[model samples]
Target: MLKAILIDDEHDCVELMVRELARNCPQVQVVGRTTSSEEGFRLIQVLQPDLVFLDIEMPRMNGFQLLEKLDTLPFSLIFVTAYNEFAVKAFRFSALDYLLKPIDVVDLQEAVRKAERQHRIDGRQLELLKTQLHSHHLAEKIAVPYQQGIIFLPVNEVIYAESDSNYTKLHATQNRQYLLTRTLREVQEVLEERGFLRVHRQYIINLEHIQKLVKGEGVYLQLSNGVSIPVARQQKDRLLQRFGWL
Candidate 1:
């Protein structure tokens, strides 16, 4: 059985969720429920449930703030919110799950099933999601998944990435280029914090490896490896902004 916790400011809602979990989701056992974020955080540290049904709004500390305080999140989260337009949009964008207020039994059952399936498929997906969520607080490091095995690369080693159809080519200062099966957009999403900039539609260059910018008749980048990359007209302004020139 999956241990779970229900956190909400409304006592009635918390009771309802607990009852629903008991009735609909036999696989989940409610370890605790609370209206206070502080108490909820404490319980989370103690119980270490398999999942948390978190409410986004609460006095003193909100749900997101509670998640922020955790050094290492102990469980997967299914956000429970009444009405927060922006928060809902963010949840969808981040590919996380949430249930709006006036929760339906069907929705609750579906959410629990999805969470269980995710846990069974790859336990590491939860860890990856947590890492992606709190990556800002982590030290700079890159783990590139490969067919042979995972490659641990320091963020500083990557010089640039170029799109090749559905794959991306990673160029590093070690005189080796790696072909990854990830799209350019996915690569951009993961490497945004490591000073990577898209100078063209097909190219993402590491700002640390840029030797100089040649902006004459047509803009081009002078890389540390003596390779010149043509900068697209539309992306030139954004590239300049990346260097704090704008």
Candidate 2:
């Protein structure tokens, strides 16, 4: 049996999760439950469970705080949250597993099964999940509130992203530039895997569009469309290494 724990501030939420675990996650034997992060931390250290169903928002200490405090993460964390916007992005960026509120039986079961499979894999899944999440979280995507929302921009279409004060400007193919509400850091996280290289703190360029590297004049890059992007002196060597020139 897989040892497990449930941590949530709401008693009803905890109870509901416990019931679902009992019914669907037969492989998991819940050894502890708690509302306080302090208590949860103690239980985790003591129990050393195989799985932990955590809630993002809680009194006194949030789930993230609890995670941050752990000397060593004990088991697979399945974050439960009612609000899906901010927390979801964080979890996705961290490559951590989470379930949205009003938890569906199907999603819950899948999450449990994934946890069990991950446990068997013994760290490989964790690494892969982290990689995938990091990539997914950084991609240029828009989550509009309503009316056929959520637009995902293909990484290939992106020429470069520039920081605009608090926001970021996405320059796509065909000279189309879009003003995004998100910060450049967030955009960097998603595009790093898709050949988006941060040549400078304020600019991230698409590697696929690079046509040629001009050795002199600060190592400027000639794009496929004949646009030249100035490559920072520090970034030249790394870019060469990335292209297997070194």
Best by lDDT: 1
Question: What's the CA RMSD for each of the models?
Answer: 8.4, 14.4
TM-score of each: 0.50, 0.51
Q: Pick the candidate with the highest TM-score.
A: 2
lDDT of each: 0.74, 0.71
Relative to the true structure, candidate 2 reaches a TM of 0.51
Stretches of model 1 off by over 4 angstroms after superposition: 84-86, 119-246
Candidate 2 lDDT: 0.71
In candidate 2, stretches whose alpha carbon ends up further than 4 angstroms from where it belongs are: 120-246
CA lDDT of 61 in candidate 1? Answer: 96
Positional deviation of residue 114's Cα in model 1 after best superposition, in angstroms = 1.6
